[model samples]
Target: MTVKPGSIHALLGGNGSGKSTLIRILAGVERADAGQIDIGGAQFAAHSFNAGLAQKNEVHVVHQHSSTFPHLSVAENLSLGRGYEASIGGRILWPTVRERARRVLARFGIGASPDQLLSSLRPAMQTMVAIARALQDQEGSATGLLILDEPTATLSSAEVARLADALRRYAAAGQTIIVVTHRLDEVLDLADHVTVLRDGKVAGDLPREEVTHETLVQLIAGNSLPVSENRGQRRLAGRVLLQASGLCVGPLANMDITLGAGEVVGIAGLVGSGRTSLLRALFGLSRVSAGTMLFDGAAYGPADPADAVRHGIAYVPEDRLAEGTFPGLSVVRNVSMANLDRYWKIARLRTKAENRDAAAVADLVGLRPRRTDLAINQLSGGNQQKVVIGRWLLRKPRLLLLDEPTQGVDVGARADIHRLVRGAVSEGASAVVVSSDFSELAELCDRVVVLNRGRVIADVTADELTSDNLQQLAHMRIAA
Candidate 1:
């Protein structure tokens, strides 16, 4: 697929559909076996492209998890890529660096101070900082190609709009952009031209006017995906399995929520709205300083994750790469790690039993490659997520806490994950899912707890839940 100059080209595909590989090749992180690459009027054999060559050709990329230093100041992060302003005496000029950073931030409409820590900003602002840093040397010119991978995956709707506006301004100024994302709405809203990839080949290419959400999904999946049957009729009528009253954890203030047995409840809120905090608190990652919790008709408060696990609670964190999977461990080990006691026989680990159980869990989660011996890190984002979820599913936890379970996974993997979660819920497990994707909440949840500034603003029932309505509620500010 060819990207036109001065256009916002969207690269769409499922997991392992070669989108990441293609991006890596363009960014010079990976060598292509046999292909040709053309940037501007220059052509190079794909195998010959390297980091140095990509840099010389002015190709800049901001990955899904940006490589910005959180502990450092924005000025420092911006200066790291492009060298610092130094004097003849070899001393770094702090004032010059700050001024340049301010200029770049303003040019990109980023509302962040140069002296502020990169981590201090919200997810969207941090993303804008990364984008500004990527284009700092270009000075708003149209000379370089900017590639952003899954930039809006973790951002809220409002945050996504903010970033989309910035990108549109950049594209309007002739700065060419290629956005590789799993978000269909982003493609519909931001892309000038769309290219869908399937199994490492271009599936379809269409202009923005010719693209709809349905058409895009069809192209990405290589066929029309089955519409999820309406689950709104399934109301929360089961026994309350987990209930929290006046819950107070980090960023969570006086929040109250109830989860029914065999129910999937979604936590909806913008960044800093305590969506993840609720999950962490429930999973015993955070202490509830002031609250009353009831688990299965008993007063419950887990001291830690192990205690929670003993009480049949499982958590899947948002940043799967950093928090979920063990890098060098095999899928079997990862799956069995949560419940090692199940395989402990007379003080000796039962390897065969562990592998047997892990294989069953892998099949249940529909893990790709169907190999339990491969390192969990070797799998794609979706497959890695499946492994992580499968690991927890092996425990048959009573309460499942999922934070952005389908954040970066492809459409097919997402459906598979939803199916797995629903199947578990059907078998007497309850779930509390925290997600920025409103549509996901609408699809998988029987009820939604909407948070605003750490307060429970709305408890939307299934009949009233819709993606658009959830987005609105998340952005609303109710008077205390």
Candidate 2:
């Protein structure tokens, strides 16, 4: 429970491990029942758990999703807490606020204009603004603590590196920082002290010197994880299930892909490299202006997702929360949404039969809580992803398209998902997986296809799939 001053501390845990709850208490978003918090020797009682009280104690939190107002300018967002320079009647001075914003932005190395709209900036810049706003008050510099929750979850690798560099600089300047992240690599790269939480209690605490990947995984899982040495087992190429020639979708040009039955193919690319676009094109979510596709010896161009689904094709979108799930729906309904026809009998919906089948698939997918009646939003991010992927299992899809399948998933659930996908592929279903994690692609795919500027650069077999190789090929510059 002791956090050293002027140090970077990382909090690691599995889903539902109370890491977020502990952070909320610190951030003044939640109240503690009994215990007191000692920040720089200043004791905060349970009753003093509000935003103003937390701010007075010099505690600030930057959430995973930025809370910056899209319509407001950067200067306005940065000056929200500490209002603008005002006259006797509280008349604000716009010039003073803009000047303050410029200084803050410059201090954080964020190359953005104070007058620029928050929505116009990229994700990384918006995160920078969030941090800059948190660090606005100079009066409590020595006593301040910055709490970041999963800051790099949606950032690209380069953006993460930049954020890490900024944090290191802040720590060097005697600022205390607490970061909650599931990415082990980020913890190792940016933290000086590490604490692992399990089931609402501290499982292990260690100095950065003593924490390793295997040790952390063991602490999080409460046991040693199985290390599979037999990786990338090559599958016998089956009959050609999908063939795309000269495909053209948004940001995708002349992309050619050949997928065989029972084979798993991985698509590797950087952000905006048309990875998601290609998957959407195949799933009929995006319009393919020019392309010829052959599916099962027939010309296959689906008019929409319904047509694609009817043709035995399933798509699990990249943004699971936004696109792949309905939060208001029950777990059973979400699980059976892709195949409602199977539950129809005599023009009446079979509710009991649907729940029964959904519960079975939920069990197979290792969904936590194992409750069919609860709303999908009640589950954790990992379990929600499981529901989205599990829904397709009942369809017995001929072609499965997955994008960033394990983005927010935990370590154990990630393994279960990989097993489920591979099991389906083994049962003669073709799969196309798009992932930014090259290691995931190497482990799950029989072949890896690298894309750069919407063009295929390399087609690598399972044996040749390595993180370094995939990274290099996906980032390699192609001549126009």
**Most lDDT-accurate candidate:** 1
Estimate, for each residue in 120-190, the C-alpha lDDT of model 2 and write its tens digit. Answer: 98777788789888887763365678999888766766878888888888888888999987667678788
Best-performing candidate as measured by TM-score: 1
Give the total clashing residue pairs for model 2. Answer: 0
Runs in model 2 with CA error above 4 Å?
1-66, 69-228, 344-348, 475-480
* Candidate 2 lDDT: 0.83
Candidate 1 has its poorest 10 consecutive residues by lDDT at 223-232
User: Which residues of candidate 1, in runs, are more than 4 Å off?
Assistant: 224-281, 286-294, 299-307, 316-321, 324-480
Every model's TM-score: 0.63, 0.61
Please, what is the whole-model Cα lDDT of each candidate in the order they appear? Answer: 0.85, 0.83
Model 1 earns a TM-score of 0.63
Query: On residues 23-50, what C-alpha lDDT tens digit does candidate 1 reach at each position?
Result: 8999998999988999989899999899
